[model samples]
Target: MVQKVVIIGAGPAGLLLAHYLLRRCNYNIDIYERRRDPRLTDISSDRTFPISLQKRGRKAIQAIAGLEEAIAAQSVFCEGTILYGKKGKLRQIPRQNPVLTIDRNRLVSILLKHLNETSSPNQVKVHFNCECTAVDGTAKTVTLHPKEGDSFTADYDLLVGADGARSQVREYLAHNAGFTCSQNYVPDAYKSVFLSRLNPSAGVELEPNKIHVYNLNNQARMLMVPQPGDQLHGVIIFGAENNPLEGLSTKEEVHTFCQEKFPIFGQLMSLEEAEALLKRPVARVLTVRCDRFHEGDSMLLIGDAAHAVSPSIGQGCNSSLEDVLILGQLLEQYGDDWDQVLPKFSEQRVPDAHALRELSDYTFPRQKFLVVEFFLRTMVKRLFHRWFPDWVKPFVFDLVLDTDLPYSQVLSLSQGWINKVKRSST
Candidate 1:
């Protein structure tokens, strides 16, 4: 008998899981998404930022064979990051390995296209603009409100919620089932930003192989990554309660502000981009910390729906993709028995998720003094570790970005500094 699987949200986690499951011919999967079909819409309409995938996230996509190559064709690999300051001072931070970066929507489009090319409608179905509104665990059914039709209920032998931080399936498990969950808005919010890679008259251009950042202050910053066609795409992140772009009514005003605060990017910014910036919605990030990821044998949550963390460290998407990888492993280990796989996944992933929150929140120091020390420590650690590899570990940020070491181990090694960061903020 074929097991029917229903996955909510066609985001990275959901779509990737579909690929993983479809490889095993016994499962039929259906994915529901609230947004319009990404391939049919303009990329900018999606309001997505660039996602940097390291080994942890890459390994997941590589398992499917050819998926990683497809994504790499559309991605930009950066070997380092450049920090821009208000006074035009620049600091370059280099990474040992190049990280693959791609706009989130572009990544999704590639995934969806590959998913279609590989899987048939009989095996897997992706429904867009269909929102899941409720889950009935005992009935083994989910109710979805589609854009063109009346609400409907579909039954599933197994239900997986990869819907993300604001997940409806997770809500059902917590409020109706016995799952305990909590959600909080992170201190920062962001608006999508775009810039050209060149300015002919000014003769200014950003490095094509680097992630560029401009810190407006302690309250706001812009982080942009180079795209394939002489474009820069990223976000203007700011304190959620304090919007730096407040009171700016015109496109020229927004343009002037960027030119003054981030002169280089400002020179590259176009009037059209400035207009988009003025009208784009500000999106706040919500972090989800759940006591458990699964409720009984029939239902489970993965990715942001399981453990959404702050993008402060760029691990939200990485960890989300990693969740699919972890679950795929457990499925193989348990011989496709979800009853055994669910509990083991919770036992293995819950601690790592909790530890990830700690790592994400404190990996970068918040204070001016500690921020300075952060650079010093990272440089000294890199040099020291080269001389005596066994005695010293790389910096926490390095471990999180550059390696696939478990988050639990990384937290254990960096807890002292993490504690200090939390304390200073308090």
Candidate 2:
């Protein structure tokens, strides 16, 4: 029997899930996204940022044949990070493994392209500019609002909510089912920033294979990564209450502000970018935590919808992709029987998701003193762990980035540091 699988939100998780299910050859997949097709849109018009994929996320992409290579072609492989301090002072932290960084929209385009080229129209269909407004578990149907037409309902043998943090399916489960959920806005907000990697006349060029970072104080910071076209893309992150760009009324003021505060990037920024920066809206991250990810045998949530965390540690997408990977594994184990897969997935993943929230929230300290300790600990741990192999585990950041250790284990090993940071925040 062919199951009709309806996936909401054609982001990484949904599209990737389609790829996995299509391999089963017994499921017809339909993905509905609230936004327009990224492949057909102007990349610059989209308010998106770069995503850094390390081991966990990359392993998931590797499972789908040729997908990793497609993504790698459009990505920049970064070996280390350069941190800029006041007066051009800097620090470099090199990584043992290079990180693959790609713009979020570009990643989506590649995934969508692969889906379209490999799957027949009858096997898979993607509907953009359509939003999932409601779900009826008993009726096995979902209500969708299309951009150009009246709202309609469609039936599904299985429904997966990869709709992101503000998911209507998750909302329905919380209200109609017994799912427990909590949501809070992180204290930080950010604006997408774009700049050329090189400024020839100024003789300023950031390393093409490195991630660039600058801190204008604890309240404001910028993290940029190189893209394929000599482009540097990142975000200017600030405390919600302390947006440095708030008082700048004109593009010239914006330019002056960047020049004074972040001179290296300021030299690379164009007047047009400054004007666009002035007009760009501030974006706040909303973190979601749910007790479990599945409501019943046929309804499930993954990715940001299930466990959205702060991108502070750069595991948001990594973990989301890993969720799809794990689901694929469970389906294999349970012979594609969702009745057995959904509950087991929740039972296995909920703890890791909760632990990941802790790691993501408190891994990076806010206090200046702790920040120093953080770098010191990270450096010492890496060195000592290399020498003493079994004696010292790498610090939280290293363990998270450099290994595929389950997030729960990583949290357990670094509980002391997590506790210290948590206390300092209070």
Candidate 3:
């Protein structure tokens, strides 16, 4: 019998899963995306600047097809991250494969091309502009709302829900299939703006191979990622108890806020110009997690849908892509045994998912302001950087950046070692 799989969302996870399954297992697959085909036109005008893809995310893309070169062409290799401490001290943490920054649109374009070339040109399909209105895990069926004003239904042997934060698949599994789930939205807000050079020939301001971060130490955090040539993309994230951007109505108010809080803005952007451009509202950063990632024999959720981490650690995209690779491996091991594989994938991934959830929540306060806490943290970080080897920083960074490690196992081993060190100190 020919088995069929229905994947929700056309993001990295969903698209990669489709390709891997098609390559290894002959599962008839269909990808349903709510947005229009991004390749046909520019659909990211409303979106913030492009997201950064880490080594892990790059690795996942490589697994599907020999796309490393294609993706590398558009990406700027980030050499190291610049961390600004409380007293205006700048520390550069270097890495071997520094995170690579790529335009979100360009990466998707490459993935779409791979999908087109790899998929069954005649039979396999990618349903663009088709919204997943409903899903039934018990019946193993999905209903999609087409752009043409029609509803269509499809049955599947398996359903992979990579639909993102507010996932309809998750809702269906919890409400209809008796699965336990929880979602937490953090209090951080983010806004992105483009900083372009007036003279096209002026040349790039910073090295193309670095992820630039200007940490104001709780005043306001700013990150600038260099694009292809002279253009730079900047994002500002701040705490918002009641949506911090709500009251900043006019260009003057926005300008005042930027000038008062973000000193780096003046360096890279004209205050008046930035305020005028960002008269719109800021974007909210939400963290979502589910206690259980699967239901019975038919359904499972991955990526932001199952575990949406805050971008403070910059692991959201990397972790989402990792979910694809891990889940793909599991399916290969337990092929056709949906009854056994669904439960095992959930159990295997739950620990790491929970660890990432707590880490995402933990990073919020580092960005939040508090005088005593800030000073204490700065002292601790300084000590760590002084005594620890260059390799240790990224390992600590990995505790958040990489979520494939079993969270509980890592924590247990870490704690045991910490206890042994304490005993020797006494």
Candidate 4:
């Protein structure tokens, strides 16, 4: 008996879940996305940002044969990150393992492409421009509204909410199934930015294999990752209460502001991009925390819908992909019986998710003094760990980027640092 599985949101997690379920050959899949098909959209006009995938996320992609190579072909392998300070002062944090960075949409596209090529229409179907408005867990039905048609209902044997932070399925569970959840907007907002990696006329070129970060202050910063075609893509992040770009009224004003505050990137930005920056709406990140990820045997949530966190430590997507990987492992252990897999997944993952939230929120301090101390500590730990491998583990950043240690274990080992940063934040 092939169980029908309905997955909401055709993002990376949902599409990747389809790939995993297809391999099982005991489930037929349907994925509905609220946005237009990314493969048919203009890449330049996208408001999405690049995602850095380290070992945890990469390992999940590696599970699907050939998927990692296909994604790597479109990605840039970054050796380290360069942080720019005032007056062209900079600091470099090199990594032992190169991070694979790719645009979010591009990653989804690759996942979707592989899913389509491997599974026939009978095995899988993806519906775009369809929004999930409601869910009926008792009846195993979901209500979806299409962009061009009337609302409709579909039935599923198993329902997965990978619809992101604003998931309707999760909302339904909270309202109807006694699921405990909390949501809060992070204190920062951001605007997507794109620029050429090189400005030959000005003799200014960012390293093609390094992530570039420029901090104007505690209130404003930019982190750019190199993409194929000599393109640099990222976001200009600012505190919600203090948006630096608020006063800029015109494209020329925006351009001047960038030149004055972020000169190197200012040299790379075109007037057209400046205009786009002015017109682009500010995006705020909403973090979600739920006590558990599954409501019943047939209903489950994953990725951003289950445990959305600040991208401070850059684990948002990595953790989301890791969720799918863990779920796959559970299914294998339980022999694809969701009745056994769902509860075990929640029991196992909820604590790690909570720990990840703590790590993501406090690992990077906001205070200037703590920022200095943070870097020094990170450097000291990296060096000492080399000499005393058993006594000193790498810093939280290195541990996350370099290893696949359970997030809970990582949080436990770094609790003191996390506590100090948390206190400083207060």
Candidate 5:
């Protein structure tokens, strides 16, 4: 009998899982998403930011033949980052391995497109503008409410929640399955920002293969990643309580603000983009931590639904995709027995999730003194690791970004620095 698998939230996690499950040939998949289809909409800039996928996330996509190629076709890769300080003080940090970057909606759209093209309707059906309202584990059913239709119930052999940080499925698990979960909004809030990568008349062009980061004082920053077609897609991240654009009411005011704060990017910004910036919604970053990722054999949580962290370290989406990769391995190992896969996945992944929380929170020093020390240490480690590959360990940032080393081991190796940053902050 073919197993009916219902996945909640058609983001990258859910959609990617559909791809994995489709290959099994014994699972029929249905993915429900709350938002309108990305292919049918142009509002991604308001809600989605550019995502940088490193080795771990990239490898997961690479495992599925042709998946990475499709994504990379629309993506721009950066071999390094350019940090902009006051008065255009620039610092270039190079990487041996390039980071694959794409807008979030573009990534999801690519995944959905590939799924539709490659899988039959009998194998996978994706429904957008619908959301999971309730889960009845005892009944083996899930209730879904669509935007323009009546609520419906669907039976499933298994339920997977890839519904993002504010997941309704996770809510169900917490209330009924004794799952422990906590969510706290990180202090930062952000709005999508768009700009041309070049300003030809002024002879200024941001590097096409570099991540551009500019600190607009201590409380606000703009992090832009290059996109195809001379586009820069990113976010203006600021303190949620202390909005950097508090006095900015109109497009001109917002433009002037950017001009004063991040002059290099401001030079490339357009009046139209400033207007969009003023109209865009400010989204808060919510970090979620769960004690375990699975309830019973029938219900499991993956991706942001399981572990959400601050984007400071660029691991949120990477780790989310990795969740599916790990689950697929578990399914293979357990001989397709979900009962065996469920508990073991939690056992193997829960610790790594918790460890990721610590790393995401404290990996980057916020204090000025520690920030200098952080760079100095990174520089030293880079040099030492090159000279004595076996004797010196790579820095946590490099270990996390450049390699596919298990996060738990990365945490163990880098715990001392994490602790000091935590101590200093408190």
Candidate 6:
């Protein structure tokens, strides 16, 4: 009998894995998403919160789409970051290997388009606006509720949960399937502001070639990434519990808080503009990590479902894509042997998962503080780039950006390299 594979969430991980699995395996696959069909509308109305698609994300897209030329056509190539330091010091920190930036909607549209074209379109059908409410891992069944109707049940040979943090699938597995998990909601809250073009001909407010950052100690950190067209999207992150504006009862209080916390921001924006955003509630960022990614044979989790890291490092999406890639490769290598493959997938990925979590935790507080260590590390990294080849930078970059490297091997190699540095320093 042919196996039935039901994947929850039509996000990057689920869609990419589906594309590969459908190509390699003959399983009957179906995808369910909580948002409405994006293809039906040109505008991305359902995506309130935006995501930035970096180079690794682009690589994953190219790998799944089977044509680098097609993917490249849709990308906005970014060299690196433009840092705005204290005393008005503006620095250009180039990545030894630059990455491209693609608009989130366009990337999702491309993935969906590719998935729609091959084999049975309905084989990987997306049930939109249908939220997965519950899962019975023991019975190999899932329950979902649509906007307009009653709850429905679907049975499958394998259930891949990519439903994101606060996942109902994870909850189901923990509650019913005896899976262990842990979730951490970092004390930081963030707000995004749109910097519209002054004039259509003015182009972007910031350079299209790099992400702009105003790293203002633990008080706050401001980042602006160029969106498609002339708009630049800015996000401001601050401590939630210690927020001075948390209990701002009136508009006047909000204005005072904004000016005090982000003076440069206040100088750039009109009081009305600042107040408009302050009137709205702030959004909290949470990081979720599970002790175990899978249990027995019936269920597994990936992406934010298994590990949701803070977006500070910008590795969350790339890491998720890597998870799908690694799992797909393993499944192909160990075909039809679920018993062997499942355990190995978990084992192979565990170290990477831990590494990603550590990186995520590292970035949040350091980026928050605008730490001297961060500045020193950045300077050292630049010097290292000048002295070494492409291979050298990716080694350090992999540790900072790609957490898919084995933790023990990474430690051993890093120590070996560092001892040479210690010898040289002496």
lDDT of 2 by residue, 254-309 (tens): 99999999998999999999999999999999999999999678999999999999
Local distance difference test values of all predictions, in order? 0.91, 0.94, 0.68, 0.93, 0.91, 0.67
Report the number of backbone clashes for model 1.
Answer: 0
lDDT of 2 at 405: 95
Clashes of each: 0, 0, 0, 0, 0, 0
Best by lDDT: 2
In Å, residue 38's CA in model 6 sits off its true spot by 3.6
Question: For residues 1-426, what per-residue lDDT tens digits would candidate 4 score against the true structure?
Answer: 999999999988898899989889999899999999999997757669999999999999999999999999999999999999899898898877899999999999999899888889999999999999989888889999999989999999999999998889899999999999999999999999999999999999899999999998667999899999999999999999898999989999999999999987999999999999999999999999999999768999999999999999989899999999999999999999889999999999999999999999999988889888988998999999999999999998899888999999999999999999999989
Q: Each model's RMSD to truth, in Å? A: 1.0, 0.9, 5.3, 1.0, 1.1, 4.9
Compose the digit string of candidate 6's lDDT tens values, residues 157-259.
8898988787888888788776778888877887765554233343324577677777676567777666567555566777876655667776567567655
**Per-candidate TM vs. native?**
0.98, 0.98, 0.82, 0.98, 0.98, 0.82
Clashing pairs in 1: none
| Tens-digit lDDT string for candidate 1 (1-426) | 799999999999999999999887899999999999999998998879999999899999999989999999988999999998867899999988899999999999999999999989999999999999989999999999999989999999999999989999999988988788999999999999978888989999789999999887788888999998988999999998899798899999999998887787889888899999999999989999999998788999999999999998889889989988999999899989999999999999899999999998998988899999888988999989889989999988888988888899989998888998999988
Look at candidate 2 and tell me the lDDT of residue 67.
Answer: 95
Model 5 scores a TM of 0.98
lDDT order of candidates, best first?
2, 4, 1, 5, 3, 6
By summed lDDT, the worst window of 10 consecutive residues in model 3 runs over 363-372
Q: Report the lDDT tens digits of candidate 5 across residue range 318-340.
A: 99999889998998998889989
Please provide, for model 3 over 206-288, each residue's C-alpha lDDT reduced to its tens digit, 9 standing for 90 to 100: 55566667665454577777777666676777776634456666767766666565544434566555664567457776667
lDDT of candidate model 2 versus the reference? 0.94
